[model samples]
Target: MIDLNQSDKRQLLFDAARELFLEQGFKKTNVAAITERANVAVGTFYKYFASKEQIFYEVYQAENEKAKRKIVARIDADQSPKEVVKQFLQEIIRTSEQNAILAEWYRNTEASQVLMNYNQECDVQKNSFVYRFLLDNIERWRSSGQFRRDIDANTILALFNVLVLLDNHKEEIGHEHFPQVLELLAEMIIDGLTASS
Candidate 1:
């Protein structure tokens, strides 16, 4: 029942939305602008996405996939578990800042919370890049004795989740002190997760 031409039109809209979001951000972008840029009829966008938010969510996912590939490729197998954990935390901040859509979510706490709540409701954490990355590497680290044998990947995930929570509250925690706090916590998490030499 799907028209072959439908995909091309949808992709055009998707690409145009991404370009516009990156250039002017979510608040400034309009659905009309997206359709204009995509060279599609204004009504055609409604056939693909319910709203600007829906299209932005699609763009966000695509951008995250790109980031995950880069992050996975950059991680060295030779690094110890501690360094890997630190790098993982650092990459969270780096990738978010690098992507405009991702940064917008952080800047708007209510929107960020809504997105996080939706993820929780859908139980998508298992399919997330960070979860899968930690799960895969945790297994390898445990086998190679780089990580504590008794500790499960979930513990590490919880720690990382806490770090994310702290980062979200950085404004209340004092922007000037957040870096020091994050550094201390990362060190503690690394020390906790690593096996003794």
Candidate 2:
């Protein structure tokens, strides 16, 4: 018998499901496969998740939190607004590329639909840390005379969100040239946001 606590079992299931989803996608990954990968009996999966979709949703949320924590950890108050925006973009792109599950999730329409439904039910978009962080940073830059006062903070934050969305297509955008594209985009945003003398 595989002896494990509730948290351990849940974590094991999540890890196994995430790998399967990344490798085979949400539609192709099944509960039995997840349990097999987790080294748990098929019935044991029910104790942790209601369905494969539920496990995939949890995995997506966990990965999103991990990426957010990484970006938050790198934030520095001493950095200039331009530097901060550039760094944030760089971190988002790096995190998306490094996390195979996240990259795969973005690539799959089925996964995205499930995530969208989950987000709607949870009101996650409004309460997201990334959304709040961008809003707060935009407000701070404007108040500090670093960014243009004419533009709304939400609008600036929306642009940032757009850049993050673009990261999903970085591979098709030419991995060799994606970094340059991001840099150029960052420069344009910084220039547009900068306060006039």
Candidate 3:
């Protein structure tokens, strides 16, 4: 018997489901598998989540929150704009490489579909801490004359999103080259955002 408190059981299920979803993706992962991995009864899954999709979305949100905390904690006003951008990109790449399960999910079509559905069902734009953080950083840089004032935060953020997607393609790009590619990407972003004379 899993003698855990309500919160502990919920966290156990969440962690198990997240790992399974990342490893096998949303389409292949089922409630039974999740419960079994969590050491809980199959029926107990319904007590926490309506479906596998629900648990996946919650897991996604939790992961995003964790990433946000890490990013925010690393921020420093003393750092140069380019340095900050490099740090952000490096952190993202490092996190993805360290978590093979997440990397697998990013390369899986079913996981992408699940993420799309979850984004559509949730207030993704408004609730995304990453987007909000990028927007704020862009505004700060522009005000401080560290970044080009011509490009709006939304456009810069869109470019950043593209870079993030590219980062997810490490297998195709070759693991050894991925870090160099990210460095080049960071340089390009910095060049584009640099204030013109």
lDDT per residue for candidate 3 within 1-197, as digits (tens), equals 54788888888899999888768766788898999999998888888888887788788777767876686688774688778777877776667556644454455566656666776678776777877777888888888998887888778788777776774466688777878887888788778788494
TM-scores for every candidate against the unseen true structure: 0.82, 0.72, 0.71
Q: What is the C-alpha lDDT of each candidate?
A: 0.77, 0.79, 0.76
Sorted by lDDT, highest first, which candidate order results?
2, 1, 3
Q: Model 1, 1-197: lDDT tens per residue?
A: 44449889999999999999899988789999999999878999999998887787778777877887788778875788777766766776678878887777667665465456555556666667767877788788878887777777678677767876785677688766776688689788778777474
C-alpha lDDT (0 to 100) for residue 33 of candidate 1? 99
What lDDT score is found at residue 131 in candidate 1? 75
- Model with the higher TM-score, candidate 1 or 2: 1
lDDT per residue as tens, model 2, 25-96:
778899999999999988889988888878888898888887887797888856898887778777776787
Q: How many backbone clashes does candidate 2 have?
A: 0
Clashes of 3: 0
Clash pairs (backbone) in predicted model 3? none
Model 2 TM: 0.72
Residue 117 Cα positional deviation in candidate 1, in Å, after optimal superposition: 4.5
Error of 2 at 102 (Å): 2.4
